[model samples]
Target: MTRCRLCGSQATASVVDLGATPPCESFLAAGQLDRPEPTYPLHLRVCTDCWLAQIPPLITPEETFTEYAYFSSFSTSWVEHARAFVADAVERAGLGPEAFVVEVASNDGYLLKHVVDRGIRCLGVEPSVNVGAAARDAGVPTLTAFLSPETGSAVRAEHGPADLVVANNVYAHIPDVVGFTRGLRSLVADDGWVSIEVQHLLTLIEENQYDTIYHEHFQYYTVASAIRALASGGLTLVDVELLPTHGGSVRLWARPDGVAGEPSRRVADVLAREKAAGLQELSGYTEFSARVAKVRRDLLRFLVEAAERGETVVGYGAPGKGNTLLNHCGIRPDLLPYTVDRNPYKHGRYTPGTRIPILPPERIAADRPDYVLVLPWNLRAELAEQLSYVHDWGGRLVFPIPELSIVEGTS
Candidate 1:
């Protein structure tokens, strides 16, 4: 009887069970393949009281993130996203030289670099030592520690309250949603604002993005549930924007409770949309398990047929979501052969469970396989453009999620 992390209620109902899986980020070395790998049950539950979809934090943060392999700077599109965000945020907030900014889970200082370039004071809070070292090397001041109430207070005492606190794609990573939101409230000045980006639960269900579920991500928040979680820490939502990144995400702008100014119409509109989508009720979640199971069967059938036809297949991008898809479908090196990634950290490693070798993107052109499975289906357009050369040799791209489809000629 696990209690809901947000509302502390026992009315949590099962949403979907993904069986036992290893941490999605746990890539393996060749030498370690023979050793036993640990796995945990990957089950998601929806809180009837608050409607927060979440999984229990069976794995500790230290075990999953202390020495992370994923670095934000490795992806060109992601870096561009960060730059655009910094440019817009600075201008929108009327920021100047004296303004202070802090970014939580600031991996490799990808976004903070843009702020520092503008001659503003900024600090990065990152938990991974490897990524933090890279951030320091890039001339970004960073604190290699997890953010909590105590750490937030210490940061405030040393550097004063931040004018802007940016938490992008990190709201779902925290195990203690209440304490984490409180820490966020403590770091911002009374008049300052906090901006949070999280993948919307409505999009996840509608788009059939079950691959995003893993041990590292604890919660999937709807606009209504997100408002409740933040309100517990005395924060109030003032604005919200929908972003196309990571399937579909929502960027929320919040201020301390009792602050002047009414919430924008966008906030009310999004909440209404969520309610209409049935995110506020349990019936909406009951059918998801069947959808997920259908995806697994459909994908496996495609891969097996491709193999029977004597067509060579490989994977593109070694993202965490790809790991979940591969492991859930019981794909192995024989089916996928190997995958390619732009990140050097994962280049020489193998994916967990499936143990498919990961190589550099250049190998795709050299091998010229018949079919390339675009594992990170959310970035299909970017990947299609980058790998357009494959079409020269009659190679087509395949997307497994949201139904299997063959994409031709970069479209």
Candidate 2:
């Protein structure tokens, strides 16, 4: 039996089983299609002891992230979010030229570039060699290494403790939750703060965002579970913010234990909300498998019906979450002929198991398909605005998750 990564308990209850799926980010080149691709069980379990929803690490970090393809800079909304975060954090923390900043999983220096432009000394710790090299080229000094207790200590020793440590959307990628939190804590000065952004488990269940589950994300954390995990590493939750990014995420601000920072009222508010949502009990997760199964059936039915009518359907965005959704629903190039992405790296590549051809966003305007399946449903508004020209050709946008819906108008 696989033990819980957070509480080390064998009382892990199976929540949802997505069968088998290949690594979501493993986009394939045309030449590599003849080779065999590996897949692993995509099962999620919740620890009865700690209520931490997680899956076993079937693949190593090196296999999933070492030479990553997903770069944060590709998303315009995400870059704007990063800029806003840098501005607010710098002012709130009273950061200046003397104050040092560090960002973990700093993909392509998207956020740190804002900090650097402010004349602050900042460094990035990114494990992806390609993204790290890109960050360096973008004028952000970065170390291409995975953050661990040892690496964190070394970074602290080499560049002094950080006044603000930012870890955006990276807390879930870690298998060792406690160790990762400890490493984050180690990088902070006594008066420093650590901010982590993660997609909230409550939102995942309520919104039927099962697509977010994949091999790379080991754990799905509730506010209560996050607090326990951080406390295990001697960190205290000082504040919490509900962010609309990534289908509803929570940005948590923490400080070392015994610090004087008062806990924000928002922290208690979120904890209460999670408890009321049944996140603290196993029953809360029991009905998720049924919900996920319903979503699969609903999405497949829509696509199959569309195919029967001889309507052409394409996809938008090549996000990792979209890969899980497509593979789970057994969608192929037939159902979704090809997907468009802003990232040039993914252009001309095929999705991992589904093998859907990825093209540049410009292809959408050229083909003008009857329907465009917005794969990254989280960015529906932004994509709708960007692809408004589709309406000119009587093309409608479709969202497959949270119940498949056809949207006609652009926001």
Candidate 3:
């Protein structure tokens, strides 16, 4: 963190220091419980010179993505979201059966399956071996590799240049931003479209969604910073859309600078919103550290009082963001007991630093805990309906972020 990764600037300011925590996705097995887990500094800093918010590159992308546990198809809503995006992209980009679409970091073909169904030619560049095999099993063509400039050129040479290159939720995972953008340009046609979806820093700050900060995400982006980041590789921003997924996100439409005209009104509007909110300067970040501290205090207070009252409180989902919230707040198995997830890969494993046991979703209904702390607060609507059966036992749900709130289940 001595220098900004995006721009070579020595002038930087501390936004929030989350202390040290293990890589959020490093789940532990029963046999490894006695071994000491490695932890890294989790402090977040912002570059005043470029306004780019980033954490130190403590861990490499290969260490985290080689054998990933997260599968996008597990969530019904997420799969549907991908399906809708594909349908819209086809019409918007003038894509047809003759056109080719390439998706970088395409997880388990959750999106390309829709493309396949439409009779459009598509290939997925996925990093995880296990998930890439699953995508192939589902009849989706996938290449198990990470996107780099060399890899992109080979793909173009073999399969031809892509008419539409879609990169969703992976703009922040890459530490080498400029190199990755060059890779994107190499894979796309001279006048092709490049669409990327990432969580918006403006919403992350305004809504107090601090749990999203983790080692996997190297940098956070506002519309202003994103415009500059994309420009580093000859990609120009032409349009932008605000999305509600992942708390709040931005869908950026870019193209090779050759055909990129003036940006749309939406891009200007979002940038103006960022400026008005003081994210361009230091004023907006001044009070963020205090707000983050308050969140940790409130969550701990509720859990401690519940324990004293002889009440059983368990967690609902085992998301990566949940690990950040759990470790930062010093929550262990004694407070949460265990958390459940639909992803079977995490079953019988333990969370990285806090060592909370992860069990199957069926465990919740069998044990009947009094209150279930919903860890994946971003999926509030989808999970509430799925967990509605809790109401039969007079159980309620708790959300820790955007302020702690307890509510009854949906009937």
Local distance difference test scores for all models: 0.91, 0.92, 0.94
- What candidate 3 gets wrong by more than 4 Å, as runs, is none
If both were scored by lDDT, which would come out higher, candidate 2 or candidate 3?
3
Candidates 1 and 3 compared: the better one by lDDT is 3
Q: For candidate 1, write residues 1-411 as lDDT tens digits.
A: 378888899998898888888999999998989999998888988999999999989998899889999999877888999999999899877889999999999999999999999999999999999999999999999999999988899999999999999999999999999899999998999998899999999989988899999888999999899999999888999999999888999999999997837989999999999988888887788788899999999888888998999999999999999998998899998889999999999988999988999999999999999999999898877888888998999999999878788888879
**Candidate 2: where is the Cα deviation over 4 Å?**
none
For 330-361, candidate 2 gives per-residue lDDT tens digits of 99887899999999999999999999999999
What are the TM-scores, per candidate, against the unseen true structure?
0.98, 0.98, 0.99
Q: Kindly list the per-residue Cα lDDT of model 3 for residues 233-319, writing each as its tens digit.
A: 899999999999999999999999999999999999999999999998999899999999999999999999999999999999888
In candidate 1, which residue pairs get closer than 3 Å at backbone N, Cα or C atoms, i.e. clash?
A: none
Order the candidates by lDDT, highest first: 3, 2, 1
Residue pairs that clash (backbone atoms under 3 angstroms), model 3: none
Candidate 3: C-alpha RMSD after superposition: 0.8
Against the true structure, whose TM-score is highest? 3
In model 3, the number of clashes is: 0
Off by over 4 Å in 1: none
